[model samples]
Target: MSTSDRTWDVIVIGAGGSQAQAMLAASARGGDVSRWLAVDRAWRPETKATTEALGMTTTALDVLTSPQELRELLGSGRLVANLAGPYYRTGTVVLDAAIETGTDYLDICDDADVILPMFERTEAAEKAEVRALIGMGSSPGTTNVLIRAAVDYLGSAEDVDISWTVDVNDMTDAAARHFWHCFNIVDPDGTIHPAPSWEQLERKTVTFPGTVGTQEVIRLAHPEPITAPRFLPVTRCSNFGAITPIESLVVAWSLAFSVDAQRPRPDLAEVTDHAIDVFRTYRETRPATPRIGSGMQIDIHTDGNGLRFSAGADTEMAEATGVPAAAGIVLLLDGQTPNAGVFSPETLVPADFFTALRKVSRGGGGLELHRLVNGEQTERIRIRDLLSQTAATPA
Candidate 1:
């Protein structure tokens, strides 16, 4: 089938690496292997081979340089999910292009700065009947969904704390660039502020189920808190995150900041490479926390009561961000998420999202839901089970 006719189901722009590859895998695992299309600025031959082996099509086009080509590609009605990020910049390529073409859009945009601007385009999306789901990655994406779920379960949520710990060893080039941009947050008053991620003053320690065990997390400049209050009826929310192999975040941040403070301002790409090299070397010499890959946990409170939910696996940066992105797209394509215009993951019905999340994960994401008693986990159940219990209860 032709893309303009009945052929392609989804075309992923900026589809060259692990994040896009993971999305393709999950989408294929959920069916429709033959109708996928891929585009990348620096698409490798092996990546092309991988796409072909999966009964897919791929082409290389720099989204930044080739606007017309991207517009032509996305002008069709097929769903377009962009995995390429550092969304503060790439949002122009994916989000703006989709909206301009009046196309439905999905992206794993983790930058809070971009999300705030995306909100301003709500009128355009609604006018064009576009359903733009941004920040579908783990920390911002699934984290937002899980927060929504807990809020729904608890009846109301006020103080919500979401923390994530990802292994530094899994940092990719795009991820590194994103690491830099997340620190520079944009406020509603148009003031761009720097987040104090490396400072020890805000350290909060928490435990996870795996080798990720327990680690200290500081406030991460992420999209959750920025986007949550806009969509959710919550008074307070915060996103805390840290990269592991101990003190790696400090080293990485120092390197990047040192370079940024240089005269004439070096390009962020160079800064990313330098920081990544040093951080990786630091991680290599230090004890490699292999089994302790990454994890995210959420604490939701209503009045004086609280509940906690955590969904984590021994996954890399890409899989953690990509899998749920694919799950969210699947929900949109399956007509489960029918709302048009701009929306967050929480805007989705919690039951539908968790069910698809479990399916796309192929039954491996360790999700736990528990009641918090005196700031301690009291009883644990499958996070998905909360949906079932909610179903059985009469409204």
Candidate 2:
């Protein structure tokens, strides 16, 4: 099974991560596993076993150093599902490799820094006739696509607010660290601009349909605010996230304070791993299954007119991120997404892509889209219903 000799329908980078696991699960469920390949620097026994069970194959070609290898690995028209992250460092390299290879690309990148630069490659991707979709994860991906739908369904959107809350049960070492790093990035605001992870907390209430009611969420630096403004017509766009059980906020604040103030702070991964170890001890002393669960929401508003809409889903963190990514990759490989240039999920994928994501995530508690008229809830539709309409309509 040599990549140089044969092309692949979808090649998933980073075979060992949680996002990869979810992508595999969604791909299997959708029966899109044929001709799939998983690539990593080194093959893990567990990942190999899982890929075997799913009828997928694995190969080793670490792109970290030899990014140009993608040219030989993926040829023109092939699609690469890049699940590797801490994307501020790795996203662009893989993207450049994809462009140089004339391959289509999609990733679950959530870093604003990574996304902004990738957008600059629009001309290069366009010239190469390759399509690249960035930030295709839950918040930035699903949330981004939902905002596009809301704007089209209601009218022009003046504001878009994205919020996320994960259940305590979904906590993982990698996720803990990823969440930690998101809080400490340098965000400027007239010299007093404190990063969201800088202990400067703001309290706001958020709801997840049929599950969570109004719960307090704190500000966090997420990529949606950075990319949403570029694609959607809006004056305000921001993202907030909180872990359920809420006490985790204290842990994050304390850890981030040390990392921010230390002269030689440990690398983000090291600090995040240590934080997870501490959290594990705390977890063992308590019972499993907290009351609330994981979910995310997108609030879209029209300024001064009081017209608004909110949409979201309640699910485990991995499914929340992976299902949407899997759907995006499927769309790209199947030629369902029409664009051939670098773009955000909101800018490139159509409303039908959101419909596809809703279907992909249906078993994971499904999705809900709601409308607010004059600051009050007006219309609510299950994602399944929306898809039914799409199905019934004639093409």
Candidate 3:
């Protein structure tokens, strides 16, 4: 289909926290107004109120069991930004419908199971001429892009390391809950398996830039395990999760372990209710505090003679995670990405995409990049030029 015939520039499915940020970014791009639509199972009063406050429109949609309905809703939109999560549970159905309708799709999915299945279905997507971009959120999202960019910087990165740390105090209830659910689903076998991102690193301890001091980090099963190796042919690649105050890390570890233990025999209704209660409690208690409750740090290390690169953002966990996904969709809508089937964030986005995202900080959010050359550190605003070749796409 031609670009102009694409009626709605984008159709965002699900009005969750991430979708809100994506929709807002899409609208802010200075295009023809009224070219976007927000669809969700139920009308979120809070989101509805916020959209009305900002002068946008939202429609109700359930893409899971309603393929016919979703096809009608998709109509001639060129892209669909999906923010529904725990991806293992709800992602496939919507993606299937999009593939069937030949609509390019993007989502912030961080589940390995989800990625593996999607990879299995790549042929179908290709056959339908659809592009499915997955894992566009923070750790798996921007972090994927960073590693790709960094690998391109090094002539041929034989070894790569990726690590992430979040200051939990800054996380919103919704963000924290989404994270907790991912942990639960990944470790449901009741085993604290090594992180997929860190499986190959012999040494897992490194100091973050800006004097955060040295801390030990370990690879866990995150979305990166599935996405990174596809783009970068590194002998070793690892991803980790860390938090400060030690206590917060302990609590996160405990909660993850508990979920792993209970998931197999979980009482679905009870678990859902408990999750809701926890989210509500976190929302009420955390944001009022003066401390910078949550922030994220990302580090990427390479093999051979190459500079190590790290980048991060200080903001609420939700924004840290959501903003990048939104930025990715904006790039896709603007035709910045090539028409490819079943791509990941790192595979499709350019280094400048991160630059643009960093420039447009909402709610006091900021991004910082650090480059270490032969143990000498340099700080910079734009790392795209420094690492452009690493993330360059083959023609």
lDDT by residue (132-247, candidate 1, tens digit) is 88888787787887777676677677878888887777876567667765555455333566544355326788898766788877665677777777777777778777777567
Off by over 4 Å in 3: 1-3, 22-33, 53-55, 170-174, 181-218, 261-263, 266-269, 275-290, 293-305, 355-384, 387-395
lDDT of the structure predicted as candidate 1? 0.74
Instruction: Highest lDDT: give the candidate number.
Output: 1
Candidate ordering by TM-score (highest first):
1, 2, 3
Q: Write model 3 residue lDDT over 1-395, tens digit each, in one string.
A: 44458777778777645445544654455344367776777875876766545445678876777778888777668888788765776678778878877788888887665677777678887788777888887777877776666666654565555665666565445445445544432432224443222234223565654434465554455767556666666555555656653455555555544444334554754665575566456445644433323334444444234445554444545666667766776677666665767878767545557655654445443445666555445555366466555445531
Stretches > 4 Å off in candidate 1: 1-7, 185-190, 195-201, 260-273, 280-291, 389-395
The 10-residue segment of model 1 with minimum total lDDT is 386-395
TM-score, cand. 1: 0.90
lDDT of 3 at 32: 46
For each candidate, the alpha-carbon lDDT, in order, equals: 0.74, 0.69, 0.61
| Overall local distance difference test of candidate 2 | 0.69
Q: Tell me the TM-score of each prediction against the true structure.
A: 0.90, 0.85, 0.80
Pairs that clash in candidate 1: 1-7
lDDT of 2 by residue, 1-395 (tens): 11234457788888667777887888788775768888887777887788778988778887787656766776632788888876877788888888887788999987665666788898998888888888888777878776766555555667777777877667776676567656654342312123444345776887666555566787777777777677767667878888776676676666655554223444855765676688767656666654576656776887533333343345677877899898887677666764577887776444567556655665545455665666565677664444343322111
**Between candidates 2 and 3, the lDDT winner:** 2
